[model samples]
Target chain A: MTVTVRPVTAADEAQWRARWEKYNIFYKRTVPENVTANTWKRFLDDKVPSYAAVAVDDSKPDGDNIIGFVTFLPHMFTGSIEDQVYLGDLYVDDEARNGGAGRKLIEYVYDWARQHDIYSVYWHTQHFNHRAQLLYTKVADKTDFVQYGKMIKK
Target chain B: MTVTVRPVTAADEAQWRARWEKYNIFYKRTVPENVTANTWKRFLDDKVPSYAAVAVDDSKPDGDNIIGFVTFLPHMFTGSIEDQVYLGDLYVDDEARNGGAGRKLIEYVYDWARQHDIYSVYWHTQHFNHRAQLLYTKVADKTDFVQYGKMIKK
Candidate 1:
Protein backbone atom coordinates (compact mmCIF):
# COMPACT_ATOMS: atom_id res chain seq x y z
CA MET A 1 0.00 0.00 0.00
CA THR A 2 1.46 3.36 -1.04
CA VAL A 3 0.97 6.10 1.52
CA THR A 4 0.74 9.74 0.43
CA VAL A 5 0.06 12.96 2.26
CA ARG A 6 -2.07 15.97 1.35
CA PRO A 7 -3.94 18.86 2.91
CA VAL A 8 -7.29 17.95 4.42
CA THR A 9 -10.38 18.78 2.34
CA ALA A 10 -14.04 19.33 3.14
CA ALA A 11 -14.83 15.91 1.81
CA ASP A 12 -12.53 14.25 4.36
CA GLU A 13 -14.61 15.38 7.36
CA ALA A 14 -16.36 12.07 8.14
CA GLN A 15 -13.22 9.97 7.87
CA TRP A 16 -11.24 12.61 9.74
CA ARG A 17 -13.75 12.66 12.62
CA ALA A 18 -13.69 8.87 12.90
CA ARG A 19 -9.91 8.86 13.27
CA TRP A 20 -9.99 11.91 15.51
CA GLU A 21 -12.20 10.02 17.96
CA LYS A 22 -9.85 7.06 17.96
CA TYR A 23 -6.89 9.39 18.44
CA ASN A 24 -8.44 10.84 21.60
CA ILE A 25 -9.36 7.39 22.90
CA PHE A 26 -5.82 6.21 22.40
CA TYR A 27 -4.76 8.93 24.80
CA LYS A 28 -7.67 8.14 27.16
CA ARG A 29 -9.44 11.46 26.60
CA THR A 30 -12.71 12.65 25.10
CA VAL A 31 -13.36 15.86 23.19
CA PRO A 32 -16.93 17.10 23.35
CA GLU A 33 -18.95 17.38 20.14
CA ASN A 34 -18.98 21.17 20.21
CA VAL A 35 -15.20 21.41 20.59
CA THR A 36 -14.69 18.91 17.82
CA ALA A 37 -17.00 20.95 15.60
CA ASN A 38 -15.10 24.12 16.33
CA THR A 39 -11.73 22.49 15.66
CA TRP A 40 -13.01 21.15 12.35
CA LYS A 41 -14.28 24.55 11.36
CA ARG A 42 -10.90 26.13 12.17
CA PHE A 43 -9.18 23.66 9.87
CA LEU A 44 -11.25 24.91 6.95
CA ASP A 45 -11.23 28.59 7.88
CA ASP A 46 -8.54 30.26 5.74
CA LYS A 47 -8.32 33.12 8.18
CA VAL A 48 -7.38 30.77 11.00
CA PRO A 49 -3.73 29.72 11.23
CA SER A 50 -4.66 26.18 12.31
CA TYR A 51 -4.42 23.44 9.67
CA ALA A 52 -4.74 19.68 9.18
CA ALA A 53 -3.30 17.18 6.73
CA VAL A 54 -3.92 13.48 6.26
CA ALA A 55 -2.04 10.47 4.97
CA VAL A 56 -3.95 8.16 2.68
CA ASP A 57 -3.38 4.76 1.15
CA ASP A 58 -3.25 5.57 -2.51
CA SER A 59 -3.72 1.94 -3.50
CA LYS A 60 -7.27 2.01 -2.16
CA PRO A 61 -9.70 2.91 -4.92
CA ASP A 62 -12.00 4.81 -2.57
CA GLY A 63 -10.86 8.18 -1.16
CA ASP A 64 -11.77 7.19 2.40
CA ASN A 65 -8.43 5.47 2.90
CA ILE A 66 -7.05 7.97 5.37
CA ILE A 67 -4.50 6.21 7.56
CA GLY A 68 -3.50 9.12 9.81
CA PHE A 69 -3.86 12.86 10.37
CA VAL A 70 -1.78 15.74 11.73
CA THR A 71 -3.00 19.07 13.10
CA PHE A 72 -0.74 22.08 13.47
CA LEU A 73 -0.71 25.85 13.91
CA PRO A 74 1.80 28.65 13.50
CA HIS A 75 2.28 31.25 16.21
CA MET A 76 4.68 34.10 16.95
CA PHE A 77 7.75 33.14 18.96
CA THR A 78 9.97 35.33 21.09
CA GLY A 79 13.07 33.55 19.81
CA SER A 80 12.41 33.93 16.07
CA ILE A 81 11.25 36.49 13.57
CA GLU A 82 9.29 33.92 11.58
CA ASP A 83 6.40 31.99 13.09
CA GLN A 84 6.96 28.59 14.71
CA VAL A 85 4.66 25.71 13.88
CA TYR A 86 3.27 23.64 16.71
CA LEU A 87 2.24 20.10 15.88
CA GLY A 88 -0.70 19.89 18.25
CA ASP A 89 -2.18 16.49 17.39
CA LEU A 90 -0.83 13.56 15.41
CA TYR A 91 -2.05 9.98 15.16
CA VAL A 92 -1.94 7.03 12.81
CA ASP A 93 -4.49 4.27 12.54
CA ASP A 94 -2.96 1.21 14.26
CA GLU A 95 -3.25 -0.91 11.17
CA ALA A 96 -1.21 1.56 9.18
CA ARG A 97 1.74 1.49 11.55
CA ASN A 98 5.32 0.69 10.38
CA GLY A 99 4.43 1.64 6.81
CA GLY A 100 6.10 5.11 6.99
CA ALA A 101 2.79 7.02 7.04
CA GLY A 102 3.74 8.78 10.26
CA ARG A 103 7.05 9.95 8.90
CA LYS A 104 5.48 11.02 5.64
CA LEU A 105 2.90 13.07 7.46
CA ILE A 106 5.65 14.79 9.46
CA GLU A 107 7.71 15.52 6.37
CA TYR A 108 4.61 16.95 4.77
CA VAL A 109 4.41 19.47 7.59
CA TYR A 110 8.08 20.33 7.10
CA ASP A 111 7.46 20.99 3.44
CA TRP A 112 4.46 23.09 4.27
CA ALA A 113 6.49 25.13 6.74
CA ARG A 114 9.35 25.59 4.31
CA GLN A 115 6.97 26.80 1.62
CA HIS A 116 5.46 29.25 4.10
CA ASP A 117 8.88 30.32 5.48
CA ILE A 118 8.24 29.05 8.99
CA TYR A 119 11.41 28.90 11.09
CA SER A 120 10.84 25.87 13.29
CA VAL A 121 8.38 23.09 14.16
CA TYR A 122 7.89 21.53 17.56
CA TRP A 123 5.65 19.00 19.25
CA HIS A 124 5.10 17.16 22.52
CA THR A 125 4.16 13.58 23.27
CA GLN A 126 3.67 11.57 26.40
CA HIS A 127 6.79 9.94 27.83
CA PHE A 128 5.05 6.58 27.54
CA ASN A 129 4.65 7.00 23.81
CA HIS A 130 7.90 5.21 23.03
CA ARG A 131 6.72 3.98 19.65
CA ALA A 132 6.15 7.46 18.31
CA GLN A 133 9.44 8.49 19.89
CA LEU A 134 11.26 6.03 17.69
CA LEU A 135 10.10 7.89 14.61
CA TYR A 136 10.50 11.23 16.38
CA THR A 137 14.09 10.47 17.30
CA LYS A 138 14.86 9.90 13.67
CA VAL A 139 13.28 13.11 12.44
CA ALA A 140 13.74 15.50 15.37
CA ASP A 141 15.77 16.04 18.48
CA LYS A 142 14.05 15.47 21.81
CA THR A 143 14.35 18.69 23.76
CA ASP A 144 15.24 18.83 27.44
CA PHE A 145 11.98 20.62 28.18
CA VAL A 146 9.24 18.96 30.24
CA GLN A 147 5.70 20.21 30.10
CA TYR A 148 3.55 21.59 32.96
CA GLY A 149 -0.09 22.54 32.86
CA LYS A 150 -2.84 24.07 34.99
CA MET A 151 -6.53 23.83 34.32
CA ILE A 152 -7.71 27.38 34.90
CA LYS A 153 -11.37 26.74 34.09
CA LYS A 154 -11.41 22.93 34.16
CA MET B 1 8.55 45.16 48.19
CA THR B 2 5.00 45.02 46.95
CA VAL B 3 4.59 43.26 43.60
CA THR B 4 1.70 43.52 41.14
CA VAL B 5 0.91 42.26 37.67
CA ARG B 6 -0.67 44.08 34.76
CA PRO B 7 -0.95 43.91 30.97
CA VAL B 8 2.08 45.23 29.08
CA THR B 9 1.77 48.80 27.85
CA ALA B 10 3.52 50.92 25.23
CA ALA B 11 5.63 52.53 27.93
CA ASP B 12 6.95 49.17 29.10
CA GLU B 13 8.87 48.50 25.88
CA ALA B 14 12.38 49.35 27.15
CA GLN B 15 12.09 47.42 30.41
CA TRP B 16 10.33 44.60 28.61
CA ARG B 17 13.09 44.41 26.01
CA ALA B 18 15.82 44.31 28.66
CA ARG B 19 14.11 41.47 30.50
CA TRP B 20 13.27 39.71 27.24
CA GLU B 21 16.96 39.63 26.40
CA LYS B 22 17.71 38.03 29.75
CA TYR B 23 14.90 35.54 29.27
CA ASN B 24 16.39 34.35 26.00
CA ILE B 25 19.84 34.18 27.55
CA PHE B 26 18.46 32.05 30.39
CA TYR B 27 17.57 29.43 27.79
CA LYS B 28 20.91 29.84 25.92
CA ARG B 29 19.19 31.15 22.78
CA THR B 30 19.84 34.28 20.76
CA VAL B 31 17.05 36.01 18.92
CA PRO B 32 17.94 38.48 16.18
CA GLU B 33 17.18 42.17 16.56
CA ASN B 34 14.37 41.97 14.03
CA VAL B 35 12.65 39.14 15.90
CA THR B 36 12.97 40.97 19.19
CA ALA B 37 11.35 44.06 17.68
CA ASN B 38 8.52 42.03 16.19
CA THR B 39 7.87 40.21 19.49
CA TRP B 40 7.74 43.45 21.42
CA LYS B 41 5.33 44.92 18.87
CA ARG B 42 3.07 41.85 19.08
CA PHE B 43 2.73 42.33 22.81
CA LEU B 44 1.03 45.67 22.22
CA ASP B 45 -0.80 44.78 19.02
CA ASP B 46 -4.50 44.38 19.80
CA LYS B 47 -5.00 42.53 16.53
CA VAL B 48 -2.62 39.75 17.57
CA PRO B 49 -3.74 36.93 19.82
CA SER B 50 -0.41 36.95 21.67
CA TYR B 51 -0.15 38.91 24.92
CA ALA B 52 2.36 39.94 27.56
CA ALA B 53 1.86 40.82 31.21
CA VAL B 54 4.52 42.26 33.46
CA ALA B 55 5.17 41.84 37.19
CA VAL B 56 6.28 45.05 38.77
CA ASP B 57 7.51 46.15 42.20
CA ASP B 58 4.80 48.65 42.73
CA SER B 59 6.55 50.06 45.74
CA LYS B 60 9.27 51.53 43.53
CA PRO B 61 8.72 55.22 42.76
CA ASP B 62 9.97 54.77 39.19
CA GLY B 63 7.72 52.75 36.88
CA ASP B 64 10.73 50.75 35.69
CA ASN B 65 10.59 48.38 38.65
CA ILE B 66 9.46 45.52 36.41
CA ILE B 67 10.45 42.23 38.01
CA GLY B 68 9.39 39.79 35.31
CA PHE B 69 6.92 39.05 32.53
CA VAL B 70 4.84 36.24 31.03
CA THR B 71 3.79 35.97 27.40
CA PHE B 72 1.00 33.69 26.24
CA LEU B 73 -1.38 33.01 23.35
CA PRO B 74 -4.67 31.08 23.09
CA HIS B 75 -5.28 28.58 20.30
CA MET B 76 -7.76 25.91 19.28
CA PHE B 77 -7.46 22.57 20.99
CA THR B 78 -9.04 19.30 19.94
CA GLY B 79 -9.73 18.07 23.46
CA SER B 80 -11.65 21.17 24.60
CA ILE B 81 -14.35 23.46 23.36
CA GLU B 82 -12.56 26.47 24.76
CA ASP B 83 -9.21 27.75 23.55
CA GLN B 84 -6.10 26.53 25.42
CA VAL B 85 -3.54 29.15 26.29
CA TYR B 86 0.16 28.38 25.81
CA LEU B 87 2.45 30.14 28.28
CA GLY B 88 5.20 30.64 25.73
CA ASP B 89 7.72 32.79 27.59
CA LEU B 90 7.92 33.42 31.36
CA TYR B 91 10.71 34.91 33.42
CA VAL B 92 11.35 36.63 36.74
CA ASP B 93 14.38 38.79 37.43
CA ASP B 94 17.09 37.05 39.43
CA GLU B 95 17.26 39.96 41.87
CA ALA B 96 13.56 39.47 42.60
CA ARG B 97 13.84 35.74 43.17
CA ASN B 98 12.26 34.08 46.25
CA GLY B 99 9.85 37.00 46.61
CA GLY B 100 6.91 35.11 45.04
CA ALA B 101 7.21 37.06 41.81
CA GLY B 102 7.27 33.89 39.73
CA ARG B 103 4.19 32.50 41.43
CA LYS B 104 2.45 35.85 41.05
CA LEU B 105 3.39 35.94 37.38
CA ILE B 106 1.88 32.48 36.84
CA GLU B 107 -1.24 33.33 38.77
CA TYR B 108 -1.57 36.43 36.66
CA VAL B 109 -1.64 34.28 33.57
CA TYR B 110 -4.27 32.06 35.19
CA ASP B 111 -6.44 35.10 35.86
CA TRP B 112 -5.92 36.32 32.33
CA ALA B 113 -7.02 32.98 30.91
CA ARG B 114 -10.06 32.85 33.15
CA GLN B 115 -11.10 36.32 32.08
CA HIS B 116 -10.82 35.29 28.46
CA ASP B 117 -12.90 32.12 29.03
CA ILE B 118 -9.98 29.88 28.16
CA TYR B 119 -10.03 26.40 29.67
CA SER B 120 -6.39 25.40 30.14
CA VAL B 121 -2.93 26.97 30.29
CA TYR B 122 0.31 25.03 29.75
CA TRP B 123 4.04 25.61 29.47
CA HIS B 124 7.42 23.87 29.27
CA THR B 125 10.63 24.26 31.23
CA GLN B 126 14.01 22.71 30.92
CA HIS B 127 14.60 19.77 33.28
CA PHE B 128 17.55 21.51 34.87
CA ASN B 129 15.42 24.49 35.79
CA HIS B 130 14.77 23.09 39.25
CA ARG B 131 14.50 26.54 40.80
CA ALA B 132 11.54 27.43 38.60
CA GLN B 133 10.16 23.90 38.97
CA LEU B 134 9.86 24.40 42.72
CA LEU B 135 7.48 27.28 42.13
CA TYR B 136 5.87 25.50 39.19
CA THR B 137 5.08 22.49 41.33
CA LYS B 138 3.28 24.72 43.79
CA VAL B 139 1.07 26.26 41.07
CA ALA B 140 0.75 23.57 38.39
CA ASP B 141 0.99 19.85 37.77
CA LYS B 142 4.02 18.56 35.92
CA THR B 143 2.73 16.69 32.91
CA ASP B 144 4.12 13.48 31.39
CA PHE B 145 4.69 15.10 28.03
CA VAL B 146 8.22 15.70 26.70
CA GLN B 147 8.93 18.18 23.95
CA TYR B 148 10.57 17.40 20.60
CA GLY B 149 11.56 19.79 17.89
CA LYS B 150 13.18 20.07 14.47
CA MET B 151 14.58 23.18 12.84
CA ILE B 152 13.22 22.98 9.35
CA LYS B 153 14.74 26.37 8.59
CA LYS B 154 17.60 28.06 10.35
Candidate 2:
Protein backbone atom coordinates (compact mmCIF):
# COMPACT_ATOMS: atom_id res chain seq x y z
CA MET A 1 0.00 0.00 0.00
CA THR A 2 1.05 3.61 -0.47
CA VAL A 3 1.21 5.95 2.53
CA THR A 4 1.35 9.74 2.65
CA VAL A 5 2.40 11.85 5.66
CA ARG A 6 1.14 15.29 6.49
CA PRO A 7 0.80 17.73 9.38
CA VAL A 8 -1.97 16.71 11.73
CA THR A 9 -5.08 18.89 11.75
CA ALA A 10 -8.16 19.20 13.94
CA ALA A 11 -9.87 16.56 11.83
CA ASP A 12 -7.23 13.98 12.71
CA GLU A 13 -8.06 14.10 16.44
CA ALA A 14 -10.08 10.89 16.77
CA GLN A 15 -7.67 8.83 14.67
CA TRP A 16 -4.69 10.28 16.48
CA ARG A 17 -6.23 9.45 19.83
CA ALA A 18 -6.98 5.88 18.83
CA ARG A 19 -3.42 5.30 17.67
CA TRP A 20 -2.00 7.13 20.68
CA GLU A 21 -4.03 4.92 23.02
CA LYS A 22 -2.61 1.84 21.37
CA TYR A 23 0.89 3.28 21.56
CA ASN A 24 0.49 3.91 25.27
CA ILE A 25 -0.74 0.36 25.77
CA PHE A 26 2.45 -0.98 24.22
CA TYR A 27 4.46 0.89 26.84
CA LYS A 28 2.00 -0.09 29.60
CA ARG A 29 1.24 3.58 30.12
CA THR A 30 -2.17 5.11 30.77
CA VAL A 31 -2.36 8.77 29.88
CA PRO A 32 -5.47 10.49 31.16
CA GLU A 33 -7.79 12.10 28.66
CA ASN A 34 -7.34 15.58 30.07
CA VAL A 35 -3.63 15.53 29.27
CA THR A 36 -4.29 14.26 25.77
CA ALA A 37 -6.86 16.99 25.22
CA ASN A 38 -4.41 19.61 26.43
CA THR A 39 -1.72 18.17 24.16
CA TRP A 40 -4.01 18.32 21.15
CA LYS A 41 -4.87 21.89 22.00
CA ARG A 42 -1.19 22.80 22.28
CA PHE A 43 -0.48 21.25 18.89
CA LEU A 44 -2.91 23.75 17.42
CA ASP A 45 -1.68 26.64 19.53
CA ASP A 46 0.72 29.08 17.90
CA LYS A 47 2.76 29.94 20.96
CA VAL A 48 3.54 26.27 21.61
CA PRO A 49 6.20 24.82 19.36
CA SER A 50 4.79 21.30 19.83
CA TYR A 51 3.59 19.75 16.60
CA ALA A 52 2.19 16.48 15.24
CA ALA A 53 1.71 14.69 11.90
CA VAL A 54 0.07 11.51 10.67
CA ALA A 55 0.52 8.81 8.06
CA VAL A 56 -2.38 7.75 5.90
CA ASP A 57 -2.85 5.12 3.23
CA ASP A 58 -5.47 5.57 0.54
CA SER A 59 -5.44 1.95 -0.52
CA LYS A 60 -6.73 0.70 2.83
CA PRO A 61 -10.39 -0.15 3.43
CA ASP A 62 -10.63 2.97 5.56
CA GLY A 63 -9.24 5.11 2.79
CA ASP A 64 -7.36 8.23 3.84
CA ASN A 65 -7.58 7.15 7.46
CA ILE A 66 -4.80 8.15 9.77
CA ILE A 67 -2.87 5.02 10.63
CA GLY A 68 0.00 6.51 12.61
CA PHE A 69 1.42 9.68 14.07
CA VAL A 70 4.64 11.45 15.12
CA THR A 71 4.79 14.34 17.59
CA PHE A 72 7.88 16.51 17.84
CA LEU A 73 9.38 19.79 19.03
CA PRO A 74 12.47 21.94 18.56
CA HIS A 75 14.42 22.46 21.76
CA MET A 76 17.88 23.31 23.08
CA PHE A 77 19.97 20.21 23.64
CA THR A 78 23.67 19.70 24.39
CA GLY A 79 24.86 17.52 21.50
CA SER A 80 24.50 20.15 18.80
CA ILE A 81 25.86 23.64 18.33
CA GLU A 82 22.45 24.54 16.95
CA ASP A 83 19.08 23.52 18.39
CA GLN A 84 17.78 20.05 17.43
CA VAL A 85 14.28 18.70 16.96
CA TYR A 86 13.28 15.99 19.43
CA LEU A 87 10.80 13.41 18.21
CA GLY A 88 8.92 13.02 21.49
CA ASP A 89 6.55 10.36 20.21
CA LEU A 90 6.22 8.14 17.13
CA TYR A 91 3.61 5.43 16.71
CA VAL A 92 2.46 3.34 13.75
CA ASP A 93 -0.63 1.17 13.90
CA ASP A 94 0.38 -2.42 14.63
CA GLU A 95 -0.83 -3.73 11.26
CA ALA A 96 0.88 -0.85 9.50
CA ARG A 97 4.33 -1.53 10.88
CA ASN A 98 7.19 -2.08 8.42
CA GLY A 99 5.04 -0.78 5.60
CA GLY A 100 7.27 2.29 5.09
CA ALA A 101 4.97 4.49 7.12
CA GLY A 102 7.30 4.63 10.14
CA ARG A 103 10.24 5.80 8.11
CA LYS A 104 8.07 8.27 6.23
CA LEU A 105 6.88 9.85 9.47
CA ILE A 106 10.48 10.25 10.65
CA GLU A 107 11.61 11.62 7.32
CA TYR A 108 8.76 14.09 7.57
CA VAL A 109 10.37 15.44 10.70
CA TYR A 110 13.69 15.52 8.90
CA ASP A 111 12.15 17.54 6.10
CA TRP A 112 10.72 20.00 8.59
CA ALA A 113 14.05 20.27 10.36
CA ARG A 114 15.88 20.80 7.13
CA GLN A 115 13.46 23.49 6.05
CA HIS A 116 14.03 25.27 9.36
CA ASP A 117 17.81 24.72 9.02
CA ILE A 118 17.59 22.60 12.14
CA TYR A 119 20.10 19.77 11.71
CA SER A 120 19.51 17.23 14.53
CA VAL A 121 16.43 15.17 15.44
CA TYR A 122 16.16 12.64 18.26
CA TRP A 123 14.00 10.67 20.77
CA HIS A 124 14.13 7.95 23.44
CA THR A 125 12.96 4.34 23.93
CA GLN A 126 13.57 1.52 26.34
CA HIS A 127 16.67 -0.66 25.99
CA PHE A 128 14.67 -3.84 25.57
CA ASN A 129 12.40 -2.45 22.88
CA HIS A 130 14.41 -4.21 20.19
CA ARG A 131 11.42 -4.13 17.88
CA ALA A 132 11.50 -0.35 17.78
CA GLN A 133 15.30 -0.33 17.76
CA LEU A 134 15.18 -2.28 14.52
CA LEU A 135 13.31 0.48 12.71
CA TYR A 136 15.10 3.24 14.59
CA THR A 137 18.57 1.95 13.75
CA LYS A 138 17.58 1.92 10.11
CA VAL A 139 16.49 5.57 10.14
CA ALA A 140 18.98 7.08 12.64
CA ASP A 141 22.08 6.34 14.68
CA LYS A 142 21.71 5.42 18.37
CA THR A 143 23.57 7.19 21.13
CA ASP A 144 25.24 5.80 24.29
CA PHE A 145 23.59 8.35 26.55
CA VAL A 146 21.25 7.19 29.36
CA GLN A 147 18.00 8.89 30.32
CA TYR A 148 16.85 9.99 33.78
CA GLY A 149 13.92 12.08 34.96
CA LYS A 150 12.16 13.16 38.12
CA MET A 151 8.36 13.49 38.04
CA ILE A 152 7.69 16.56 40.16
CA LYS A 153 3.91 16.39 40.28
CA LYS A 154 3.75 13.07 42.04
CA MET B 1 27.10 30.59 52.88
CA THR B 2 23.80 32.09 51.71
CA VAL B 3 22.72 31.57 48.09
CA THR B 4 19.88 32.95 46.01
CA VAL B 5 18.50 31.49 42.81
CA ARG B 6 17.04 34.00 40.38
CA PRO B 7 16.27 34.39 36.72
CA VAL B 8 19.36 34.75 34.56
CA THR B 9 19.99 38.02 32.73
CA ALA B 10 22.28 39.70 30.19
CA ALA B 11 24.72 40.55 32.96
CA ASP B 12 25.05 36.88 33.87
CA GLU B 13 26.55 35.98 30.47
CA ALA B 14 30.19 35.67 31.52
CA GLN B 15 29.46 33.72 34.67
CA TRP B 16 26.86 31.56 32.96
CA ARG B 17 29.28 30.75 30.16
CA ALA B 18 32.12 29.82 32.49
CA ARG B 19 30.00 27.29 34.36
CA TRP B 20 28.18 26.07 31.25
CA GLU B 21 31.57 25.28 29.66
CA LYS B 22 32.55 23.37 32.75
CA TYR B 23 29.18 21.63 32.56
CA ASN B 24 29.90 20.47 29.00
CA ILE B 25 33.30 19.23 30.09
CA PHE B 26 31.69 17.29 32.90
CA TYR B 27 29.58 15.46 30.34
CA LYS B 28 32.63 14.90 28.08
CA ARG B 29 31.16 17.17 25.42
CA THR B 30 32.37 20.32 23.65
CA VAL B 31 29.82 22.99 22.70
CA PRO B 32 30.83 25.74 20.34
CA GLU B 33 30.63 29.25 21.69
CA ASN B 34 28.13 30.15 19.00
CA VAL B 35 25.64 27.65 20.37
CA THR B 36 26.03 29.04 23.85
CA ALA B 37 25.50 32.55 22.50
CA ASN B 38 22.41 31.41 20.70
CA THR B 39 21.04 29.70 23.80
CA TRP B 40 21.59 32.80 25.88
CA LYS B 41 19.70 34.79 23.31
CA ARG B 42 16.83 32.34 23.36
CA PHE B 43 16.58 32.63 27.12
CA LEU B 44 16.30 36.38 26.80
CA ASP B 45 13.86 36.24 23.90
CA ASP B 46 10.33 37.15 24.96
CA LYS B 47 8.57 34.96 22.47
CA VAL B 48 10.37 31.71 23.34
CA PRO B 49 9.25 29.69 26.36
CA SER B 50 12.84 28.72 27.23
CA TYR B 51 14.14 30.23 30.50
CA ALA B 52 17.19 30.29 32.77
CA ALA B 53 17.91 30.68 36.49
CA VAL B 54 21.19 31.14 38.31
CA ALA B 55 22.41 30.61 41.87
CA VAL B 56 24.42 33.43 43.29
CA ASP B 57 26.42 33.04 46.50
CA ASP B 58 27.34 36.27 48.18
CA SER B 59 29.56 34.53 50.69
CA LYS B 60 32.02 33.60 47.95
CA PRO B 61 35.11 35.51 46.84
CA ASP B 62 33.38 37.63 44.19
CA GLY B 63 30.94 38.89 46.88
CA ASP B 64 28.04 37.95 44.62
CA ASN B 65 29.48 34.95 42.77
CA ILE B 66 27.42 33.06 40.24
CA ILE B 67 27.90 29.46 41.26
CA GLY B 68 25.53 27.56 38.95
CA PHE B 69 22.52 27.70 36.67
CA VAL B 70 19.39 25.86 35.49
CA THR B 71 17.66 26.23 32.11
CA PHE B 72 14.11 25.04 31.68
CA LEU B 73 11.06 25.21 29.39
CA PRO B 74 7.51 23.92 29.24
CA HIS B 75 7.02 21.40 26.44
CA MET B 76 4.69 18.63 25.37
CA PHE B 77 5.65 15.12 26.44
CA THR B 78 4.02 11.67 26.35
CA GLY B 79 4.04 10.90 30.05
CA SER B 80 1.76 13.67 31.23
CA ILE B 81 -1.54 15.24 30.22
CA GLU B 82 -0.53 18.86 30.83
CA ASP B 83 2.54 20.60 29.51
CA GLN B 84 5.55 19.76 31.71
CA VAL B 85 8.61 21.87 32.24
CA TYR B 86 11.75 20.29 30.82
CA LEU B 87 14.78 21.19 32.88
CA GLY B 88 17.18 20.97 29.96
CA ASP B 89 20.31 22.13 31.74
CA LEU B 90 21.24 22.05 35.43
CA TYR B 91 24.75 22.58 36.67
CA VAL B 92 26.55 23.40 39.91
CA ASP B 93 30.14 24.44 40.43
CA ASP B 94 32.22 21.53 41.68
CA GLU B 95 33.34 23.48 44.71
CA ALA B 96 29.72 24.28 45.51
CA ARG B 97 28.36 20.73 45.50
CA ASN B 98 26.36 19.18 48.40
CA GLY B 99 25.47 22.57 49.76
CA GLY B 100 21.76 22.26 48.89
CA ALA B 101 22.37 24.31 45.73
CA GLY B 102 21.16 21.52 43.45
CA ARG B 103 18.00 21.05 45.48
CA LYS B 104 17.49 24.78 45.51
CA LEU B 105 17.86 24.93 41.76
CA ILE B 106 15.30 22.18 41.34
CA GLU B 107 12.96 23.85 43.79
CA TYR B 108 13.31 26.99 41.76
CA VAL B 109 11.98 25.15 38.75
CA TYR B 110 9.17 23.74 40.85
CA ASP B 111 8.24 27.23 41.92
CA TRP B 112 8.12 28.41 38.34
CA ALA B 113 6.11 25.38 37.31
CA ARG B 114 3.65 25.90 40.14
CA GLN B 115 3.18 29.57 39.35
CA HIS B 116 2.56 28.72 35.70
CA ASP B 117 0.21 25.83 36.63
CA ILE B 118 2.54 23.38 34.91
CA TYR B 119 2.44 19.85 36.30
CA SER B 120 5.83 18.25 35.72
CA VAL B 121 9.59 18.97 35.44
CA TYR B 122 12.11 16.43 34.17
CA TRP B 123 15.71 16.03 32.97
CA HIS B 124 18.19 13.34 31.86
CA THR B 125 21.49 12.42 33.48
CA GLN B 126 23.97 9.64 33.01
CA HIS B 127 23.22 6.48 34.98
CA PHE B 128 26.78 6.32 36.22
CA ASN B 129 26.49 9.66 37.95
CA HIS B 130 25.41 8.22 41.27
CA ARG B 131 26.23 11.31 43.27
CA ALA B 132 23.72 13.42 41.39
CA GLN B 133 21.31 10.50 41.42
CA LEU B 134 21.53 10.37 45.20
CA LEU B 135 20.16 13.86 45.42
CA TYR B 136 17.77 13.22 42.54
CA THR B 137 16.36 10.10 44.13
CA LYS B 138 15.64 12.10 47.22
CA VAL B 139 13.84 14.80 45.28
CA ALA B 140 11.95 12.72 42.71
CA ASP B 141 11.24 9.19 41.63
CA LYS B 142 13.48 7.79 38.90
CA THR B 143 11.75 6.69 35.73
CA ASP B 144 12.58 3.51 33.79
CA PHE B 145 12.98 5.14 30.40
CA VAL B 146 16.17 4.85 28.33
CA GLN B 147 17.26 7.59 25.96
CA TYR B 148 17.96 7.15 22.24
CA GLY B 149 19.00 9.86 19.80
CA LYS B 150 20.53 10.46 16.37
CA MET B 151 22.65 13.33 15.17
CA ILE B 152 20.94 13.71 11.82
CA LYS B 153 23.11 16.68 10.89
CA LYS B 154 26.28 14.64 10.80
State which docking tier applies to candidate 1: high
The residue-by-residue lDDT of candidate 1 on B1-154, one tens digit each, is 8899989999888899899989888878888898888888888899998899999998885567898999998887767778889999888899999998888989988998899999999999998989989999999999999999999786
Q: Which regions of candidate 2 are displaced past 4 Å?
A: A41-48, A61-64, A76-82, B45-47, B61-64, B78-81
Model 2, B1-154: lDDT tens digits are: 7888999888888899898899888878877777778788888888978899999897876535999899998876755665778788889998899888898998999889888777677778877788888888888767766666656666
Score each candidate by Cα lDDT.
Answer: 0.90, 0.82
Q: Model 1 reproduces what portion of true contacts? A: 0.92
Residue lDDT tens for model 1, A78-114: 6777888999889899999999999999999999999
> Which regions of candidate 1 fall more than 4 Å away from where they truly are?
none
